[model samples]
Target: MARFLLIHGSAHGAWCYRELIPALTALGHQATAIDLPSHGDDPTPYQEATLSGYADRIVSELQAIGEEVILLGHSMGGYPISLAAERLPERVKHLVYLCAYVPKPGFSLNDRRREAEEQPLMEAIQLTEDGLGWTVGDDDLNRLFYHDCPPGTVDLAKAHLTIQAREPSTVSIETTARYAAIPRSYIRCINDGTIPPSYQVTMSEDWPSERVFSMDCGHSPFFADPTGLAGRLDQIARDIT
Candidate 1:
């Protein structure tokens, strides 16, 4: 069975993967998720959260796992997972980008978002007064993230979502051959409202045809179709192995 490490996106924590974790386990693979600094129950202040801090937490978890794992990053999670793999390539068997940003050398996630042809998510973001963090607007959250999700998903998200530190998205990252050598895959959410499906295609256009998969759901597949997402991940595990 393949072991999986799942990382969440902006303002979200491990709680977002509640459905998918058990679904994957039922499929005979091991899956674990963690709260990045300042997210979920993490006590770190949003002002203190940084991209490197996120990467460090992921690295520590990988070291504790003590074995190779398939690292999956959802949305803004791609940056940290990429950095973690760069730091401990030996512990990562593959990197999976799930409707997530794939970092370009020297470019921050914010830079990539700005580069996208369409700025669909811009309307939903509410910047804090200090300019250090952002939160999703209440009205836009359901429309952008959970339009296709189950009944309780939006409520769960509303209760747990926290301020997303802007620093992490503003900092650029550098990767070397160590990170490039790892197997990589991308799962595009075809109906994603936050990150346009067309942009997802643009991001993964250069990847091998076999490495790019698509889901017919919006941004939050964990709640929309957790079992299907787990099955797709299982297929990815098999394909890579």
Candidate 2:
């Protein structure tokens, strides 16, 4: 069975994968989730966060594991995982982007969003007074990221979501041929209101058909459809092996 490292998206901590982790484990796979700096319980200040710091955190985890594992990145998590793959390609058996950014050599999250055919998360952002972070409006959070999620799920998300740092959003990722050589796949959320489904398709048009998959649920499928999500992830991990 494949070992999996699940990275959460913007304003989210590893706690967000509570359901998906167990579901993946039920498939007889070892799944682990980690909080990025300033997220969850981490004490790093939001103003101090950087893209390199995010990547380094991921790379440290991979190095400690000392074995190749499937690295799954959600939302903004994609950029850091890409950097991790670049730094330790041999330690990453596969890179999976779940309604996540599919970065190119010199594009930041903001840059990609600007280039997107359509973006749904932009209007939902509530920037911090200090200009170091942003948060989604409470009402928009349910609509944008968890429309299909179960009742009470939105409340849980609201309670746990951290203020996402802005530094990483402006930092563009740099991918090399070596990182490109690492097998990558994308799981598109067709019902996604955060990142439009059309935009997801646009970003992955060049990828082979087999490398792209879709979920009927919204962005937060881990909460909306854990069984289906887990099954698809299991199949993806198996296919590459």
Candidate 3:
């Protein structure tokens, strides 16, 4: 059995992995989903967080687990999880990017964001009145985030959605060749409006593992096809092991 650290995307917390955690546990693998500082239960306020803060939180939790783990990052969670794997290579068995960002050394998340040509969406996002670096809008959420999600689930997600910190998105990560040396995989959601398939292919090209797995769902496959997503994750663990 492998230990798995499941990191969630921006505007989401450990709450996003509710279905995934139990599924992984039932398969005999230990799993933990964390709420990045200020996003979930940490309660530090969304505007106050930075990429380093997120990465630090992941590393701290992994240390507490005291076991080697398969590191899984979704969306924005990819940034920190990638950095954590770079920081603690020994404890990471495999690095999985679930429709997540894959950055090069010294590349910030915003660099990839602009490269993905998502400036229109970014511009449409409305930040808090105090000028905090976070923004959200219903149209943006439905179109980019939960396009394929059930209406009811989408409503629930929107109701609970929090503004994402602009800092993490703007901060460029400083990575060594450490992560490239590790085993890596990408799970791409074919219908992901939030993250384009073309972009996924572009990002996957940088990795030695040319195998970019496909999912016939939207961006949030965890909600769209939890069973299938869990099954795919299990397969990856076996394949890497």
Candidate 4:
């Protein structure tokens, strides 16, 4: 069984994978999700969050694991996961970008978003007074990211969502050949409003066809269809291993 280390996106935490972990486990895989620094229960201050620091936490998780595992990054998580891959390429069986960014070397999430055709979250973003963190209004959050999600998922998320630190997203990730050598996969959400679907296609155009997947869902596929998401993940694990 492949052990998948799930990484959540901006403003979310390990709590975002409440349904996914169980679904993956039911499919005979071991899955675990952790809060990245300032998100969820972690007390790290958002102002202090750094891109490298985020990657360090992921590397620490890999160091603690008994074997190489599938590392799946959701949304903004792509950045740090790439950094983790660079640090421990052999520790990752496959690097899966779940409706997440597949950044170029030295490009920050901010840089990548600027290259997008649609800036869905542009108006929704509410930055902190100190310019350290960001959040979205509940109305925009529901419209943009949770439009296709099941009822109550948005509410559950709204209550738990934290102020996303800008430091990490703005900081460029330094990737090397080792990061490129790891097998990679990208799951594109076709109906996604948060990140344009066409942009996703453009981002992973160079990726091998077999590893690029498309789901008939919105931004948060893990919430929209955890079972389907797990099935896709299962297929990847099976094909790769």
Candidate 5:
């Protein structure tokens, strides 16, 4: 069985993968899903969090595993995961980006977002009064992040969704290698409104391995199809090995 380290996106915690972890674990893969800094119980202040801060958090988590593991990142978590894999490529067996940004060196998440149609939607997202963070209000939650999700699942996320840190989202990424050096794969969600499918296809073009998969779900595939998602991840792991 392959060991997997799953990273969550902006404002989301390990709680986002609660449904998927058990499914992956039941398949005999050891999955470690942890909250990003300042998002969950990490206790880091949002004001102090940067892209490097987030990358440091991922590296710290990767260090705990004695064996090489598949490093899977979602949404904004992709930036840090890419950096983490570069820093310790040996420990990262393969990098799986789920509708996440896969950027070149010195590029920021904003750069990737600008290359897509997501900029307009991001600019329209609600922000805190200080303009330090971004979040979707209850009215836009279903349409933005999980339109295809079951109404009940959307309601559950509405109750649990909290404000995401703007600091991390705005921070630029600094890296040494192009993502093409790693055995990378893209898991595109076909109907995602938040991340335009056009942009996903463009980003995957730069991947070295080019092992791409698609789900007919929205941005939050883990919530929409945890079992199917986990099965695909397992298959990818096996194919790579």
Candidate 6:
């Protein structure tokens, strides 16, 4: 069985994966999630959260595990996971992008988002006055992230979402062959409202078809379809081993 380290996206913490972790554990795999910096219960101030710091946190977790594990990233989490893998390739067995961004050389996550043809999330973003962080507007929260999620998802998210640091997304990353050599897979959410499904296709276009999978759900599959997501992950784990 593969051990998995799941990373949440912007403004979200490990709490977001509440359902998926147990689902994966039930399938005979070990899964763990962590709050990245200022998100969730972590006390790091938003202004101090940087992409490298996020990667460092992930690296520390991997070291604590003391074994190779599959590193999975959701949405903006792609950036940090990629950096972690690059920093400690031996600690990572595989990289999985779940409706997540796949970083490009010299391009920050924000730069990539800007390059997208459709900006579904633009209107939903509420930037902080200090220009250091941003939060999702309540009115667009369900529509953009939890449209197909379970009934109580929005309420749970509303109670837990935190201000996402902007520096992490704005700073560009440069990955080397160490990162490129690791096996990777991408899961595209077909009904995604936050990140367009078509753009997901474009992002993973060069990847082998076998490494790419699809889910007929929105962005928050952890809430929308945990079992289905688990099944997909199980299959990926088996394939990897």
Tens digit of lDDT per residue, candidate 2, span 1-241?
9999999999899998899989999999999999999998788988998889999999999999989999999988889999989998999999999999878767898898888877688888889999899999888988898888889998998889989999998988777887989998999999898888898898888899999999999989899998899999999988988
What digit string (tens of lDDT, one per residue) describes model 6 on residues 104-202?
A: 989999988887889999888899999899998899998999999888899999999999999999988888999999999999999999988999999
- For residues 183-224, what per-residue lDDT tens digits would candidate 3 score against the true structure? 888998888877777787788875655446889988898888
TM-score per prediction, in order, is: 0.99, 0.98, 0.92, 0.98, 0.92, 0.99
Runs with alpha carbons beyond 4 Å of true place in candidate 1? none
User: How close to the true structure is residue 112 of candidate 4, measured as C-alpha lDDT?
Assistant: 94
lDDT at residue 19 of model 2 (Cα atoms): 94
Clashing pairs in 3: 108-172
Task: Report every candidate's CA lDDT.
Answer: 0.94, 0.90, 0.81, 0.91, 0.80, 0.95
* lDDT per residue as tens, model 1, 1-241: 9999999999999999999999999999999999999999999999999999999999999999999999999999999999999999999999999999999988999999988888888887899999899998888888999999988878888999999999999989999999999999999999999988898999999999999999999998988999999998999999988
Cα lDDT tens digits, model 5, 1-241, are 8999999887788888989999999898999988777776678766666777777878888887868889999988888898787777778888999999886555678777887855536644788787777777777777768777656877777665666777665666565554446787899988887889889888886555449998888899998899989988988988988
Between the candidate structures 1 and 4, which one is better when assessed by lDDT?
Answer: 1
What's the TM for model 2? Answer: 0.98
Clashing pairs in 5: none
TM-score ranking, high to low: 6, 1, 4, 2, 3, 5
Pairs that collide in candidate 6 are none
Worst lDDT 10-window in candidate 2: 113-122
Cα lDDT for residue 59, candidate 2: 93
Best by lDDT: 6
Identify the runs in model 3 with alpha carbons over 4 angstroms from their true place.
Answer: 117-120, 206-210
Clashes of each: 0, 0, 1, 0, 0, 0
